[model samples]
Target: MDSKTQQTKWSQFLSLIVVFFFWGFVAASNDILIPVFKKWFVLSQVQSQLVAWAFYVAYFVGSVIFFIISLKSDILQKFGYKKTLAVGLVLSALGAFLFVPAASAASFWFFLAALFIVGLGFSVQQIVANPLAIKMGSPQTGAHRLTLAGGINSLGTTIGPILLGIVLFGMGNKEDSAPKDVNLTKIEIVQKEYQTHKDELAKNVLELRQDNQDDPAKVNEVIAIVEKNIADLDTQISSINQNPGANENQVEAYTTALGEIKQRSTNISYPIGFVKDHLKEVKMPFIVLGIAFILVAIFMLFSKIEDPAKEEEAEIEEGSAKFSIFKYPQLYLGMLAIFIYVGVEVSIISNLPALLHTKEFGGVLEHNIAPFVSLYWGSLMIGRWNGSINVFNMSKTTNMLMKFIVPFVAFAIIIFANELSGKDVSSFYIYAFWILAFIIMSFIGGKAAGKTLMIFGLAGVVMMILGLVYPDKEIAKYFFISGGLFCSIMWPSIFDLAIAGLGKNTGKASSFLVMMILGGGIIPLIQGWICDFDKTSPEGVMGITWTHFSYVIPIVCFVYLAFYGFVTPRILKKQGITMGETTAGGH
Candidate 1:
């Protein structure tokens, strides 16, 4: 590449990175929204997840419209990238502004509508930005550039949960008292009491453990004896209370005795369970905060970008009517690849927080801690960053090997970790496995675009199946999070492969690709309906559970993606034009 062309390529790469960052921030915020809506709207588990369905479904719907427009014989040749992006920005901004009203009225439908509009805007942005990134550089460098963009996008994901957590959960007291209106002294008292309770619980658990080991057979017998004595003391105190002539000092002594007895009972039982239960009770505010955070992210995107269509005209003249890009079989298959990739990605992230919060799966951590789901985002960032750097260094075959091996190893680690910890493994283990998988996949992606994605897609299907079959919560969460590792490269790889050679027609084809994001919307809703339906039982048999149904979404998405990976690229080669080329459009 020449110096001037190199500079232009870098600039274009930077612009797409910004777009990716925005999308990552906006898209990942939906993870926070699901639990938030569940709390704010008092929705059922399935109902709350509709928040994701409502937002992502727009990608599919909007992309279809854009795909149709692109078929109008080089519509992008008439409009250009700058103009298309500007229009998308405006629509996204309008979507963000809608949140203010949605929040004020607490209207769920309004929020969904706003998210749909935002999805439409993002669809346009995706169409324009993705192809532009590839065209500005060589295919070797293009994936790297997109991966860098994915990294910045992960940064936004990291910040989003923390920022929203502070806004929502940090402001509240656990005792059902509104921190916003409470006096400082009362707040301090509440905090002190909370800390005291936590400390006391820790001390009691240690004491109970010691007691249990001191005499395993006699511990329960001793506990029952202590409980009976306490109950008898309580009855004696009540009898004293019934005496009309009881002295004030006698009453004070009885009260003190009752307090001592209660303390002894708590020590015997180990109060850690009670402390954890109280912490769970304080999660409502955190849920609300998560919702607010996403609204703010939507606002940020809307304010920052503009609609590309309104900005400028394309330098290229309209192409002859002889060639039609839409008629190509590879192009259609490529669109399917994009669709499935997005669906798999969305399903993976959306389900993580819920899995961490499910008690049946031995969720010991509180939901407030669930926002740390950003750790998965952090892992993705690491992968994309390394993938970008390695894109230039590694050969296709070497990179492909790493991608396949990395996820497999990560899955193994997660399975081992879950087994070791058994039912008591912390949620942090989920994040660890995710990071490990991402690292391996990044090395694997190298420069072989189509094959890299194919590997990831197949891995996604395997992980989803594992999650469905496993009854263990920790194992299920591990598989779900590991799906992220396999999924990390599918989006950019599939995109670059699909639009490989469309010259002047790249922008229009890009639009078609963006429209496929509607998969995010459609798949999640379908999953939601499936989950809801499963919860409804017949007379004798149990209903389908979320664990079983959740697998269906990713399985369906990956099955398509796997097909696209193995078959779509070869089909593209047969077409005598890559996804980036302006060939005679064929179906």
Candidate 2:
């Protein structure tokens, strides 16, 4: 309740945001998986979106379960924040571990289950962390601390796609030295002859189809001949490859050729009956992520993390007079705000790969989509970083300059990392100007979470509208991607508004708010269904182009958020509530 106790705990704050980074990393990386799953399984848009559904729906389930348990007892209060965090990390690690089996089996449902486990872990973390961030510093500047933590979260989002791309696509990877199992002399002869035969046979089959246009019998005969040749060539290559006397050169050539055959063949099947090469590669990064979570959990067990609730036990007892968090309309409305905000944010980013892959949209190559995904998530980091500047202990002038500089600094970091990963970032340079607009909006609304929330929410709505309107224009891409920039500050802003005066109920309120993460699950599914435009039906009935029309989901979401932002402050004022001492000393 006092200003002195409210000063930010810098070291503890830094320690806490590690979980935030993990949340962002895994969440954004789901975008990459969506397209991959769709292509591999030949899934409908709705079917592939089970990725988002399985992952985000866990939050609602976990939070509801947590809330029910708390009806009898406060779990965080009993277990303590540090222990709760460690447990969450362990759960997350367990989830990541599931990816190993999921990928090994190449089971799509297994992958969903793995993501669900991860989401459950994140739910607990969100329940604990959101309230914890607010309580870490002065009640006035609590929003700023959360914003700073979100900036760290955004950092993970920015890097996740690029790094995961490397793992999945083998981009920029160097070939290892050739294996020493090949019969070098015979290997060369076999490989050369195989390639010659393969090419000639493939060409002959194509010509047979064309030349035998009126002779099905002749076409079948030529196809049979080519198929037999291919089968015989494979046997010869296999015999040479398995020979112990084979040299490294021969082994390498044979290995490379076999891989090419798989790549070129339309109906390629994995011999292992589970993980294929690409799926296995994708599984590697997640397995490593699982290991990292375990290590972090171990560290958390030993680390001395303060529980803000414990420090204010007496005040909490006093504030405990109110048991039901829903008594406050702001809390309930804010809960919906969090839900819609998350739903729209996830829907846009998760579907971006699909949108870009469409011939009607950007049509970006599968492997090349990482950088654009990075841009969407990175844009969030830029806005959050800008908002984070207010939380730092700096002169007013310094803060202003940094507000402008920090986003572009974050932007530079994204561009640099992406460019190094082989993505051309030149088109994204214009986004910095859009970022400048974000900066201007930040200063215009100052530091009031509710006011700024309204402003940013409206801005988000505008961006979505532009994206929908000019769905095909190059400029529309900027409009759609800039939605992240507008959305960056909303989580902290809405959280700050919703829990402003809830006192002891803040913890319960946090759970309810976290439950709204269900929106992330449902909204994308709805968009996917809409994206399944029945081309067979008369046009325009579904609203817009299937891809573009789906964006309307986000537009409606932002509209609700903007209205919430506009009304919440007035409601708080009528109830004599004000966030006491903001980082900028306002409101």
Candidate 3:
């Protein structure tokens, strides 16, 4: 556990983060997939979120399987970390390959199954990699190593959207491409405005329908107003449809709107689920990513990475700890923390494009918003890269300079990636200040995981509140997106603190922590449900109307995290394990 021993495994440690990178790439890419799936499949907001639910819920299910297997025998102990990781990669490859058939069949269930398999694979990978990252170095610097690996993971997140967008939308060379008849510009504006007002319009119609016992005169007046609004919307649709320039796609879009308007009337009902359409355009990307997963699996199979816990193997064999990790209250709290951490992180990014497409919020299209999505994930990269400077054996002056320099360097990479994908990123220069704030925050914590967790968690709460407070302001969108920066170090911080002195119970405890990823599945669905039109009032049986207000879910999540951060150190102190106090060569 000393610096000298930790320094010896540097090469194998370097290769270990490759799995981390893939996990980030695919996870962030799901945000891109969400809107695309929602549009093509005609899914409701809550229904579209099944994409996240299917993907993340697998972590819980897979961890439970692993936990059950461990109850019978130590899976990781028997198979070893390297083999477990390789097996996970192979399983993920199988999952990625499923996307090909899923797309070909145009089956939403197939897509969910593919994602579930991928998450199942990730379950094993996470259990192995998180503990492996910790075990590779001194216990004191375990979190730092995990933070450094998270920086690599965030790099995948930084570019995942642009790359996936190029593959999904095929818009990387838009300047040289001929225009389609879709009338995207008009559709973009109208869809944003119409979606913004549609909920209120529907609420009014429902209220009017509920007034059967009211005065006939008043009922007639409300019905007349609703009819007039429908007529106006129909007139606009007719104009768009009759335009000389209108193409098949535009006409189809208008026809869909007319259908929706009709469905909103008293005699008709709106369809409330995903519609299956034969979509062959998005097949190749899945096939390609699946093949890549196999290649990575092969690389891992032959790689030089060692069994990470060989030193502790004998002790583990002789140990007699119970299967339950609940004995440690910190572990249970950390499980909750992981649940919400992944929940808040996933939900924020996943729903962002939904928020951006609204006229009242960002008013950006799916194609145009990839860069912003890139920035949200890149914000994490910026913070982690800065926090990771200590992993290198450098001089204090060098470390300090690199801490300041690394974040902007990461930011430049994000900009360059966006530009390559035909996006104009010059508008993002303002985020440099937020990047600086993250750097300042990193230095304030000074390599302490608990301290950093508290600072960053509190920052997440403040930023989310700013988003809710100023939902109509441009700063609100960016503030909510900036939650990624504050969330950058939370996993490492909370993971290290949770498993700190568990020793023999660490593996089972790790499984328990991974199980909490169920939060990612549950929280986003809750947010999506809250954003439903039925939930128009926060105090009602439903929730609020504004899309931005759904952010309260993550705000609540971060509050618990800040509490965990503030109290975890005290918990560790009770066990006489004080972290971040020993001065090392790196920090």
Candidate 4:
């Protein structure tokens, strides 16, 4: 704990953060790919979200495998952090390589399987990286150092979309956009969902007929309703196909139906119409990513990265009694909080691309989407930069000044990033106002985990509400984008709170928290499903209109998170733990 050991090992820490950069790079990159994939494969917004599902669920799956293996022995302790992380990278590398065949074959499911493997590698990397970040610095400053690492992760997120955008669609000086083309025969997703709805309608009708054998009229009325829905969807599909064009409502409602008027493409941006060329474009990005992973894995294995001394099974923290996982309310509640927290952060950016495509919004085509996506992810970077201010180890007055100054500095970085990627930076000038407000809120939130969580969670809830209510779609879109601002530091706050008093159970609790990263996958798919809810509801509004209304899902998630923040402190105090006192966190 002396000054020498207290200083963070800058060189070693830099080496470790490379993995963090790539994690955010690939993750934020997923949002960009979601729309591209939707266009490429004629996928529903719901089906398109399988990109996130496949990637994040692998974290749950990998963590489970790790947990099972650890019951016999702690894997990190046995293999050591550096080697374990290397192995994870290799696993991810193999997964990335799988993308080649997946793209070459134009198989969406295969791409998912490959992405799942990438997520599995990240699961291991996440496990090692979080603890390793803390160990790289002083015990007292470990959490602050982890915040700094999270900042690096955010940096990755900020640039990921921008760079990926250029890689996908270079320097934005383009001609006319591609025609909306989708394959009719390959509209299996629509057919599958249709069958599901049909089966449910049939089941309901059968039950009603059984109960109302004497009242055939009741069952017949329900049958008419079901048939009307079926016919409506069919007519909508047929109208668009016969004319070779359709309104956005019809397209969003049954996106895969555009497949009926399939045509080839001449533009690489719209190359999905030309199946062969478009599928070929997909391989290069992933293959390049895979090679980078393998090279990093090799460097990590050979590099002189230090591993902290491992603790024994009996490593009880001072003044703490061993408690079963059942006794920890914060642990369980915080698990779900972590789940919801990760989900909302991810879903906002994931679905924003679709939101941007609508006429009510900017109606920007795919190439134009990078700026908004970049800004959303960049918002996280801004907040993380502020959160990492403690890394400066300056005077209290300087720390306060840094808190105010650092966020703007991060904003500058974001602006610079957009410019570097050859994107329009004018719209970003106004977003600085939102960042300014977040800076003020950050002052109000301070350092306490519970207070920060409650405040930020509620802020997220309000932003979503405003996004729903705001009349101007142009300005309203920023409300949705501001979600990243609120979500910035939630991961650490929830993580520290969750493991606040776990003592010897700390490592195990951490693993479970990592498993909850699957929320990243689950929430977006739910929102996308809501976005594609093509039928009319009892309220007489089209469920497809829920694209604008799907903000409700994120709203509910923030509400629970705010509740968790409000209640978890009281829950932990009963076990004699202070709210702010806690362990490290990772993205």
Task: State the lDDT at 575 in candidate 2.
Answer: 88
Off by over 4 Å in 1: 1-5, 8-16, 44-46, 60-87, 131-143, 171-327, 363-366, 392-446, 500-505, 538-544, 572-587
* TM-scores of all predicted structures: 0.63, 0.79, 0.79, 0.81
The candidates, ranked best first by TM-score, are 4, 3, 2, 1
How many residue-pair clashes does candidate 4 contain?
3
Count steric clashes of candidate 1. 37
lDDT score for residue 131 of model 1: 53
Residue 288, candidate 4: C-alpha displacement in angstroms = 2.1
Which regions in candidate 4 have their CA more than 4 angstroms from the true location? 1-6, 174-273, 311-323, 535-544, 581-586
Per-residue lDDT of candidate 4, residues 1-587 (tens digit) = 56346778888888888899889988998898898888767677788899999989999999999988986777877888889999999999899899788876677888899999999999999988988877776777777768777877888888888887887778754222221123443234344334434443455345444543334564465456655554555665455456445455554446433221111110112122234445566677788888999898888888878888655334733323454667788888889998898888889888888777653463456777887888888888888887777555589999888888888888888878777776656656778888888888877777788888899899999999988888867678899999999988888889878988777678778888989999999999999988775323312133324577788999999999999888988988888888654322349
lDDT, model 3: 0.73
User: Model 1, 1-587: lDDT tens per residue?
Assistant: 44224433564456446666667766766777676655445465567667777777777776777766655644455665666666676677677667666665566687788778877777777666765655555554554555556666766665555444444455322332211123434223223333333443344344444553344545555446455654555465456546535465665454444434433433343232222332342234324433443554454344423333322235323532343656666667888777766766776666655544432343222234333445555445444544544544578787666655544443343334323322222445445555655555544543566666677677778888777677665456567766655666666667666766665565556666666766675566556555444234311123224544566778878878877777866876886755431110000
Q: Encode model 2's per-residue lDDT on 371-448: one tens digit a residue.
A: 888999998888877776766689989988898888889999998997787655666777877888889998987987
**Candidates arranged by lDDT, highest first:** 4, 2, 3, 1
Task: Pick the lDDT winner.
Answer: 4
The candidate with the higher lDDT, 1 or 4, is 4
Worst 10 residues of 1 by lDDT: 578-587
